[model samples]
Target: MKEELGRTIQQLRKVQCYTQEQMADAVGVSVAAVSKWENGVSCPDVTMLPVLARYLDTDVNTLLSFHKKLSEAEAASLISELSDIFFDSGFEAAYAFLLEKIREYPGSDMLVLNGAMALSGAMALSSTLVMDGDQKAAERYEEEIERLYKKASESDDPAICSQARFMLASRYMGREDYDGAEALIDMLPDEQAYDKRQMQANLCLARNQLAAAGEIEERKLMLAANSLNMVFVTLIEIAVREGRLEDAQYLAEAADSTARALDMWEYTAQLPWFELYTHRKDRDNCLKTLGSMLASVTDGWNYTSSPLYRHMRKKEGEERFGPRMRESLLSAVEHDERYAFLRDSEEWNRIISAGGGTDRGAGQDET
Candidate 1:
């Protein structure tokens, strides 16, 4: 607690453009005392704490570095806002916004961890752009992200520490710092005694929160169904690659059947068949599959109708591309060189003119 308090004091002081000597004068303490407090070598006298906190423009709780702890939903909402700022305004704007929030909630471990994540993503995106000063901006963002990750890694919350360490390991790996990556990876647990979702549900049940437990189980079921669908798709891909077209067809059917049985998204059910038909250059089937894929996106499908996922609710900030996504899919098919064979086909034209495949397309007929 003393160490955390010291770090917070130093951070706030620096942020307010205060030197140790200046802080000492403002708080009526010696420069040496301020240095000790910042270094965690000693703490401020009890009476002087409020004075020091006032000087740093923060309250005692913030100064002690336990002012706030964001709930998961709050953190997710904040991250979503940051992402919108990064994409719409610019990386600089997003970075400034996150910095302001960090100053406001210096003791929020989730905020710090999520801010680092947002910065890391924006920095990576900027690095990929061939623009002036992008390299320098990426470097600056990287330094701040690393600092925040290191700070969060020291948190008492195991979840925050683990996420911070994993992100740090990823950063190291990106820079070819193999030894650093390996060390961080070694700190992570290889297995857990119980899955966190199930454990949480059990806890809810113990507390007689039956509805909450049911919701958790419903979410778990939805995730399991999604994962199973992906496994089937992956096996189909591998089968096709190994010249096992027959096996691939069988797997694709299985994947489609599984999606229907689980009440999965319409697009997901058609995905495997699209991949398979494209690989075999089956133009007729490809056009049909593409139409079904586009129809799903345009028609607005959700899991609410699914009996298996009835208790699960959509999370705030979940990605929804809307009509623009359908347009992009249609545009890709119309212009991409890989789809040249489908471009002039009568079926392709019909599908496009009808504004992407209708409900009569592939998955609809199959199910």
Candidate 2:
């Protein structure tokens, strides 16, 4: 811990191009004391933190890092609190709050880690609202996503580093930077946990540990379900790319049916149907499908009659896509270049007309 403090002091001082003697003079300490602190041979008194922090232009918390280690439970609680702040206030406000937290505990890799997660989640929620020729918001979000992941990549925590590298690779894939993505992926630790888990499961079975075996079997079942979802997802993506719209829609429905059976959270699974309808210029069917799909998910009277919804949670901002997020997602679909033809259609206009002052509730889907 003392060694870490020493390194922090040295790094901050060097970033400002300050020598040991200069730092000591600024903080009214001898060069020998500064050298000892930086060398890990000695630590500074608590009383000297303010002076040391001022000289380094940092907070005492940053200088001390974590004087006492945070428990996993405590860290999880903090993560949840940060998430709530994000949903309650707004992205900008949550970002400001996270920045302050990072400054306060500069060495807390979890802070950088959670910030990356929050920003990444916010990007998805915000992108739904982006439309053609209005990409300013999307650009800002992607830039911040890159910045946060890059910061997390430098974290000391292995878990934090691993997740950051993977997310960075994903971002590179989105940008078609295949080489960059491959480089990032190459830095990740190889998957050993799978082998270990299988070994443990085998051991449990051999020992007649029925309870343990059941838990392992449950985990294996979950993994199998996820694998099935991935396979179908890839096929659906291929269908969409190939312009096999009907096939894509069918596969999507199949996937969603399986998803609902597994009690998983569902998102906008019908957006592709809109694209297909628009492509065929079948305005009426397109609008009907859109209206029905929207009706199924939104927190409106339509949900009351839908068999897909048994009892809906009315939590304000905790849905798979919350009210604002759903609205934004719909806007993104509306402005997609492929569906621009629908923008002028009377069927589309009908929904637009309904979305006036008389029907402005975030999730009020009315035909």
Candidate 3:
């Protein structure tokens, strides 16, 4: 019986273009077990038989037939459908469905791992969705995220483990549990973690913001310079809000020098930096920057649909800079019809009616 079963397993595996190691990995079993099953030295237990059948895309009865009881084409179709569901809808939804299928065909590691992956994916998505600052939602997301992380960690697949760790770190960040976030991040492989140049720059900005918030004044000029050069526009907004005009100016200057050094003088970074200059009562610089930006608006550099740009143009017009600003405002109206919708929006009307002050009261910070 073992010899016959091994023969059957070998034939089915070959038909599916799977190596023993590949099949073993997919089914969460050992290559030795697959080898034993194929060599007729041993047959899998009754529990593992259903798992093997599912993994090889055949029924137990057909597998026991010793000869072809099912067509290879039919088995291929079933395998293709399973692969599609697993890849498309992701692991959780597919796993939920597979769990029901497992009940009908018990003790199948093929179903188990597939279901586990689906469950993991569902948990990851849930964590991401609930990542907003809701305590109850965060708790729920964290629970599921931890469960998936544990499961993935115990699995042989290093990729899945890495992904789970990344998601866990993200969840920790969402909950403002920076210690937990750091722990998880430190555990990740450098290649698997958020260590891209842009990401590192953003991280520096976040750390600087945290330092500023905490009033930890050690005067880290390098930190400020790196963050401002990478994420100057955001710093400019913060500066404007906090009435830190000098800091904003310094940051903008640093960003401008970096942009020029990188030969990106007409980059998107310049637009908001120009707005920052406008806030600093530098109308000449703002006008000059806007003029340069307009000239650089080729197919590659164009971003006419930006609402912020429209708002900036409106502000520039109100400042009575010149006809050039007026023409830009007119061009914005002509290009993006979405600006028309924005003008008619209730929020816009309320803002206009309140003279740009919120109903919550002026000088009331909602941070």
Candidate 4:
């Protein structure tokens, strides 16, 4: 087992284009030490096994030839690393490598599950890319996603099954198969210990899609509004992306009403008022409302310096439309010291700028 582990370690090192000297340097050992370990003349000390495993980007057991002896957490970590490689690297390479590993670790369910997850993630990524252009590739990705979801659903673990169900619903929704998606959602246990809000959101989205396909405009509007309010914060995002300002306004109003109905002032406070202001073109009113909202938001988190705030300020100064309003909003966000979490994220800047690297013009057409 030790010899096999040494061989595997050597193989992975070569695959990563690392020389014995380089590997030794990374693991804090001598070149002769690495050579001796690889040749099975000697093995790394127990304390160094973790460092070696980490450098090799494999599990310690895999490097120590004790695949069958790993704890559950170790096994899970191995699966996770394999999934990352499969998703981040080319499919052909990941597939070839997994096929080899499966032959060696045929009894390992963790290995099999990781392979499924890797395929699913890859398919989803490919589908998103192709859905923007190549119809055939998009369809292929959808098919592969379904296949992987089915494989995952066969697991007895509730958590795994719930994830599979969610992915299946998402894929079905992507294909506009609302009925099939809803059917999968219906199969989920009511008391299942999963992310209930997310499941509910998916169901709401499915219902909205179905309503949009129906004959009743009033019913469609109501369902769409209900769906939007149920997940208003996210719906605002979708509306903005689709350049559907009127839709955003409708959803925002609905969200406001829903929040009132449920007495969820805190949640309602998080809904972006600037969205409604943008649609209404009531710049002064928008600024006033934004001031209040920003104050409340800052009160909740404590104002801290954030990349988003800085970007917003810069864009506000540069852009002609709503520059003053944005600047005011930034001041509101910066007024308190509790909202420190925003500074932790580098993407905050991109988020505030709509990822377009430009100041948004105020009166541009929705498209």
- Candidate 1's C-alpha runs over 4 A off are 1-4, 7-41, 44-67, 116-155, 164-186, 199-209, 232-250, 270-299, 317-367
Give lDDT: candidate 4, residue 300: 38
Q: Where is the poorest 10-residue window by lDDT in model 1?
A: 358-367
TM-scores, all models, native as reference: 0.62, 0.62, 0.31, 0.36
lDDT value for model 4: 0.54
Each candidate structure's count of clashing pairs: 0, 1, 2, 8
**In order, what lDDT does every prediction score?**
0.78, 0.65, 0.52, 0.54
lDDT of 1 by residue, 1-367 (tens): 6787787887687556678988888778799998888788999988988897778777777777665656777777787888789778877898888877777676677888988887775664553433464676567667878988987887778889999999999889978999999999999767778798999999999999988898999888878888888898788779988999889898888989998888888888998888787667778788888878888887776787777777777766554444645755776666556678888888887887888856535632243
Q: Which structure among the candidates has the greatest lDDT? A: 1
Give the candidate order by descending lDDT. 1, 2, 4, 3
Which pairs of residues have clashing backbones in candidate 4?
301-338, 301-339, 302-337, 302-338, 302-339, 303-336, 303-337, 303-338
Model 4, runs deviating above 4 Å: 1-72, 83-88, 98-115, 127-142, 192-230, 233-367
Give me candidate 3's TM-score against the actual structure: 0.31
- Give the Å error, residue 301, model 3: 6.6
Evaluated at residue 213, the lDDT of candidate 1 is 92
- Evaluation by lDDT, superior candidate among 1 and 3: 1
lDDT per residue for candidate 4 within 184-279, as digits (tens), equals 999887765675445554675678753323323333333454455557767776887788978877776767766445433332443445555544
